[model samples]
Target: MAKEHSLDLIAIGRSCADLYGQQTGGRLEDMLSFAKYVGGSPTNTAVGAARLGLRTGLLTRVGEDHFGRFIGEQLAREGVSTQGVIADPQRLTALAFLGIRDPDTFPLVFYRENCADMALCVEDVDPAFIRSAGAVLISGTHLSQPQVFEASLQACRIAREAGARVIFDVDYRPVLWGLAGRDRGDDRFVAHEGVTARLQEALPLCDLIVGTEEEIHILGGTTDTLAALRAIRARTDACLVCKRGAAGCSVFAAAIPARLDDGLTGRGFAVEVFNVLGAGDAFMAGFLRGWLRGEPLEVCSDWANACGAIVVSRHGCAPAMPTWVELQAFLRGGDRPFRLREDAALEQLHWATTRSGRYDELMVLAVDHRSQFEELCRQTGADPARLPAFKALALRAVDRVAGGDPRFGVLLDGRYGMRALEAAADHPYWIGRPIELPGSCPLAFEGSADVATELASWPYNHVVKCLVLCHPDDADELRERQERQLLRLHDAARKTRHELLLEIIASRNGQIDDHTVSRAMQRLYDLGLRPDWWKLEPSDSAAAWRNIERTIAANDPHCRGVVLLGLSAPEEELAASFRAAAQVPIVKGFAVGRTIFADAAEQWLAGRIDDAGAIDDLAARFAALVEAWRAARTHGAPADREIA
Candidate 1:
């Protein structure tokens, strides 16, 4: 292998979306919805390697559709290079709809029949880019088609010629071959002489080969597992890994003899099985991590086993792969009190480490309160048609803060702020949109299920900010239902690939204080609602913030940090609150709605203030808050004081 390469690994072939039904223990026909996640073996492996802190890239073709965009964005988010992931404008991206009918049977249907991935041609293969990789991983399915087969071989040959190791993942999928009219039923694994011949040609060039027993059997042209291993060994001296589900795995390198009970084997981490579909891809990713890092054979196997164990017990393919920290934590201890599959800490670690872009601390402008603006219009005797103008004020504020301050975003709604959102979409600025009704104490959504539908239509850049009017003192039934709804919203946000910014407001009917807000947040955390950012009411004291921070750290330290909310207070009052919030390091910035725009909006609605005047006033108010926040963040927290 080359001593230096631009990429640690470049994975080639199929990329698709895996929509796994959340309703487990049911038929696909009975399921109402499925969770969308990035799928395809090579794509998963690339993402997994990237998650393990490897500089990886993917070589594949995805349709010009949203699913293809999602796959690209997801890869980029995981720090995987997508230079070779071509966007085929004519074809649709492949999809795999899977359902967990039981522990053993996972109902899967492939939607790839002449899909974008299958159309991969040698013309699409960039030889120079392939040569830059330390290793090139060729997926077995890529060899099913003549064009993709040629492309895969071309890339592999180029990488090998450049002193790059060629790794072959025998990711045998009978359904894919069947689509090519080469195989029968996907469930029936038969060793085709032609397929074996093609695989054998690539095996001689591989430095490493990983596969399940079935995959190995196909490549070695035998049903007997041992015979297959021997045949493969005779053909090439490449290190071979055989993945045995739950029994761990066995590694057969040049130095070790393969046996049932010996030769560089590692025990698999025991996990409660949920789905076993993507375990192999996760295993390959883990193995690549250890191999590239020059870990011992046993350690590499352990890493592979750990990754496989974690993914098998989770939901989807690439998303289920563990981060480096999560893997280390799993290796150190078993899933313990909180199962590793569902551990919030591990989830947060993935969230924190897998950031796609780097941005400075946020300075958000809140303009997403739909009902509040309507109420203001009603009180001021102005037509509701003027709401868009009111929202434009917030956009104007955002424009004013643009170049001068880099860390600014606006929280607007599609209802009143569609223009603002469309405009912001053209620029590279942070944007948050509310998905809840204004003053529903029980946390009713403004459009209920339609909120998710709206979210689906939005660009990936917008944040889904849901305002749940929470009260610790609310009835248990209401609290439980609210929790359920928020959980649904959280899942929907994840489906749409939007960063959730959960805004929680403690009910003023009770003694609305920091303690109440803290408890409310804790309750949600207990319910497993970990948002990327928390839009919180400003705490009265530093002690209150400390309490909230403790809960956040324990629950999800990967949280993007909290932002103070303005309850339509005066500029001075909001400034005082900003000072207190800025003292807390966990507080990134503020999202003040009324304090900045309510009065100006009201005056504009009443025709007392012109568009320029209203925009100017809103800009000035927003600027004042920004100044206060920047000063507070710079000078540090002030002395502790009691709330008046």
Candidate 2:
């Protein structure tokens, strides 16, 4: 087949045979009934871009086996030009087994060894075809192997030399590199060292770099979005784009000569997500479409966010992507309401809780409380008829706090031999479960003894600190103990090479002492320990800034980074202080928590919390806060520059 003259996009990479299964139960061992689907980043991007009304072509090498035929048929069905895809008789097609265990966790197992995709050589990609395309989209996974790496880089160089814009998606997969014989040692899968090295080589030649916040962090070794952006911009002139699932996307461009907006501004649009599997590809497709149409960067981001929102509401990758018309309709209309039955919602919550590392059986006790409350309402003294109204009020309370509604609720007019026909509500014990917030690393406990072990056990990449409830009167003592414990834990973690985290409740203490901090740092150094990052309650005091600076200077080479949690500090001073201290490059990133949990707890404790409405509000607010923090970091003056 001959190549087309002018293509909107030339997506070059792997085409895999996919095996998919939907989870019947929340447990990992639960028997799952699954269905097969076509999967691969390159194929998905081509299909996604085509569905968004682009004339897209795919350039890859596939086996002459049944999987290859399937890939060809799927691409043709999706309207992607596949003339450039080559069929290799020497190798078998790559295969991937995908399991959607629940909304938050999806596990994938790949069987790719000397696959046809890796068989692609420089000759397989046509120089003239790449030159004819408006943009060339390359996946980072393919670059793990030496043969494909060289070939893909050659294609990127050819496209660049031809004046074509190149888009690089840093889809880092440690397994893929391992298959290529790269020994990463202890930092094997999680660190993604090989992929980062490859990205460094390709990034300088590309016009755009598209990656998730996690991917960027892995490549740049920082969770701060702006730091990641600056790191990439420092190496290349590509328009840097960082994808924040559900919250939105950010675009950073260098200050050009006489360009409008200077491309340093950041913006976000809200999104409702259902299945986040291929949302990134959808965003890339939408962004490319907008960029091709000469739209503003902000509008491109909005379109990308809209497209991602549309896909997450549906199931699967290619099947979920909306056509250009559907995307337009969705944009014209408001947010799509989630259509979930009560049973479905319950099942989802159950699945979410089970897979969420944050919540264990002990922490999630609301189900039992609801059952007990029902029995109490059935007693003789209770007015059974008033139970319904009272239950409604109690339900409102559960809606007020973080993870409150789905995991808890209230019942009214319980009999329990009471003379008055009154309603009752109870606070449920909270089990902290790991949550993967958009645009940040998976959170872990600050003072955890086995950080790596705990991180491995976590279902997702990020870990948030568990709530530490200390009595107001004992706050000072608790703070002191926590500081002492943190020092000991830091020493222990260094010996074990585990990441240490220390989370202190700001509302409990009202303030932190320098003595405690000094002792903590001294102990950290004594044990040869440095944290990946520390999450502290934001403060404006000179002491806090000084502590941060000193800590970063001391642990510059050893620590991953430091992040200031909670958005209570003055933004101007915080930024200024961060920049001044960021003189050391190893002081990688910064972040702030939204205070959603605090706000929700305050409402629940104050008797103003609503059960039914709280969960969604909390999630939305949390997502919004993360979006704002990321935006500020992206657009904030360089960490070395003082705030004006």
Candidate 3:
């Protein structure tokens, strides 16, 4: 297998829609809705391998419907080559409705009769494409149908002739095989001699075979595990891998003994399990990732186990797969205790790092302050009419700071001042719009009562920023109400595909300590609020920032890094904060409002400075902050430059 080749692995099998029930720990009858995600053994493995940095492709058929289109889109998003995946307008895509019973059990019903995948024919198989891949993996279910079986065998022959390794994943599902006199009670280990004989015909052509213990039982035509291993060994000289859930997986080379004790075992990671359905696919993808990369068998097993551990602790199969960086981070995280909330951050990293052309770092302009702007208006006794001019002045500051730098975003409230938001809409600058009401105690929205409904209409590229004034020590009733509102906002943001920025301001009256802000973050995660970005205040110490990072990892590993809030700090002090924040990798950018635009805004409002003069001052201040932030990132030093 040459690394220079285009495709590393091409998977052939079923591709379907997995309707996973949203309500955990409940039966399907009790669930009202299910989140749609791409599923199927081969598809999941392909997606997982792609996420782990493999140049992968899929050779399967999907229906002409949206589910099929969704599967194609997801594969494309994950960087998988979908040129081989055909669309069958004659048949619909397969579907599986899944429900979580417990950590060890998940109930699933397969609705795949004359599905598109089963309709695959010999004519659909691309010989040249299969030959180009370093390896071709075929799922066992493909052999159940005579037409698809012929196609699978043809792909295998073409791949083998081209010197590509042939791998078989015995994804044995008893219900899919219609054999009379079969004990339907046991779906795991159903032994039929006819099926075993049929599977054996393809075994001699395989260089590698993978299956769970029960799957092996069916493939070997024996209930005894050891007898099954021996039977497989006699049939083929291929490498065999036995998947043991939570106990990890074992690999046996052709020269190895049939017994499990003789095979190489990779210790499994100990983590809280939410669903066990997709763990096998994740493990297979991980194992192949290591094997295809020419890594040692032991290292492959470790990758397999770690990958499986990550999927079991989350939701859907393909979406839950970790990228190479996330896997490395998890392995490097050591024996430390990990919570499920923290997995979101890693998931974010997995999704973010795999994509092309993301900003290396961001230098966002902070103009999303409504309460402070109103306060300035109050202090100067200026009419609220002048606020629009002030906001217009802030736009000039954004333009100056963001000049020639694509890594800049502006946060402005559309409710208070629409001028800035409208001006920056079609501009190159990244825009984030605030949805929270000005000076709300437990949080309130200015427009429609439902913040989610209002935000649903916002542009996709515009980030929805929510500013919440919360305290860890707040009264229980107020905290509960706030949590409910925040969860509603979170659900809406996810459904609308809008990136969210959560700005949490600790209650001003409470005794502020290092742990206060981080604990506030953890509380939101506990209530199911996973924001893409967290707008935070400058921390007092290095240890405090580390605690915040840990908190982000636990609650939402997918969280974009935090941005430091100005809290109306003096320009010199805010500069120092930027230097401190740049030292933290988890701090990607800054969003400081008053420190950048306050002085100019006050001068313009009080009639001490003209409109042009105020605009110039604001732009200079904003540019100075941008310079200080870049310097802090490039050179490790405090922001010592005076504000001109």
Candidate 4:
């Protein structure tokens, strides 16, 4: 039987009231539209673990004010035991102002002057709590303050003594420790230099060290991820896990070599991102989940990838976390198809130009018989001249799916003898184009390099290559051939200073084995090409949709939008409730089939949907419906109505 208090994760240090303001192209003093959310690295980790069904507790200090109450309540609601959370009546809670300029990054300003969290002393932490937990997790941020820092260190020591593993997250913030206080002279440069020194003090005691590439560099003074991991590992017996953001995570343990001879060492999974905030915490939560379950290091990396993927695909931190059911569903290939709106489409075009690195652009080439190609083009409203460019554009589109940005163009042609395009239909870069084959012609293009280079040169930060083979005889051959083409494309794209994405799509029900696809993908990994690939049957789409619908329906308050056969009262109710709970506008709409419905809904929600030249007509309609309901309720009130 599992222990009575099995696998309790105790998270300590640093709590803050994170105030976020959306930039509306105005000055900082203009009183921008702002939103407040509770934030703290430890708080986030605790909540993340709890959401994953772990017995978790948070030990931190907040002020006696309303913000402290809010933080306590938020943790409690997330199923995190806040018994160890203390309120400091003498000091105020820490405050951090976060400004979101884009989904990938944000600007932060901290206002923590002797904050309550910093007032935490060694006597505050309950020894029983430390002894009961399976692991005690702490962050390096608290080390800036002596009292709180000592308290956190002592707690970790106590937990370790009580037979609990110690997990240290080196979340280094230069500004926090950069201030020229009395004890440390006016050496302004000391703040940045002090981070590594402080981290070194805590390294020997930590059982595990989790950090990003940047954090690793700051801590170990090295840019190379592998070298940093080894350097840190040599100092402590702790396992070193370095997060590479979009590229995935690299894990190193003493028993395990840095690289495998069979080339099966660092595991990776490409993720679709919306906001990168709290992604590290999500990854830590995931890694801890696997570690608690006694899973292998590789599986642990996969969990971290899955958790980080889910968190970054949403807006906020705690609210964005997926439940255990949602994670399992996603792992089981139950994610819905990509959807796009006009604004997202335009943003993709803009993002393509502004961002640089990987091909943020996607290209989808649809191949099918004559009748299928013609019918698909007619249904999708794709143009014939743009058919050749559609494949590259669609591949770019898939990268932006997490942002709900529509960025691909569709085309229809009858040049190839195939019926429809052989591409992932749900891929963002796929343009829903279907080309009819004229007869057996040259399937391989002599100037494929030119096309590949042009596609790679798009303005997007990341480039993705998607290949879908619908022809039975062409599947195996196409898979190998496409890999070579992608490598060449990747080389060309890199020459132009862009990141290349090469994805292969196959049917799950087909003769192809998943291990074969994994092995093929592993080869790409060896070439430093980490791409997203999927193998699914035709009916997999419906199953994915059903899973999404169920998730939306069950978590109504958390679900921001609903896609059904068409807009209905049920969807409206869900949207209304989500808006009320999250305190943000909610979207309610539907897609007819996979393509048509998703496109329309994406545009409508993004305020780009046009019906009779009216932007957000569907959204306005829903708003009106909600307004009328409010009016009816107001009118239904009897005179005086003072029974209560």
Best by TM-score: 1
| Backbone clashes, candidate 3 | 12
Q: How accurate locally, in lDDT, is each candidate? A: 0.81, 0.56, 0.81, 0.55
Residue-level lDDT for 449 in candidate 3: 79
Better of 1 and 4 by TM-score: 1
Looking at candidate 4, the ten consecutive residues that score lowest on lDDT are 584-593
lDDT, model 3, position 478:
88
Could you give me the TM-score of model 2 versus the true structure? 0.49
Candidate with best lDDT: 1
The local lDDT score (0 to 100) that residue 594 gets in candidate 3 is: 77
Q: What is candidate 1's lDDT per residue for 337-390, written digit by digit as tens?
A: 324556656655655655456554787778887888889989999888888867
TM-scores for the candidates = 0.85, 0.49, 0.67, 0.51
List all candidate RMSDs to the true structure.
4.6, 21.9, 8.0, 18.7
lDDT of 4 by residue, 436-519 (tens): 123212123232337444543243323332333332334556556655655565555534434332323334215554243334
Model 2 Cα lDDT, one tens digit per residue, 1-644:
43344788898887877665555225434535444456778887788778778999998988999889878877876788888889899999988766554566656667777888888887787887788887788888888777788888888888877777788988766667663233221122355555566678887788888888777876665666556566777788888777767556666767332322244433444443455667778888888888876788887887788777766655567655667766665667543355311222222222222121121111011111222333444532444443344333333333443244322222111222111112222333222222111112122243235544443333221222322322223445554564454445444433232333443343443435643444445444554434444444444455655665576566433333444444444445555544443443333333332233334433433446555444544445444433333334455434344222
User: Which is the winner by TM-score between candidate 1 and candidate 3?
Assistant: 1
Q: Model 3: residues >4 Å from true position, as ranges? A: 1-3, 179-186, 255-258, 338-434, 438-463, 468-498, 502-531, 534-644
lDDT of 3 by residue, 26-134 (tens): 7677887677888999999999998888889999999999889989977887788999999999999999888886775677778887999999889998887887799
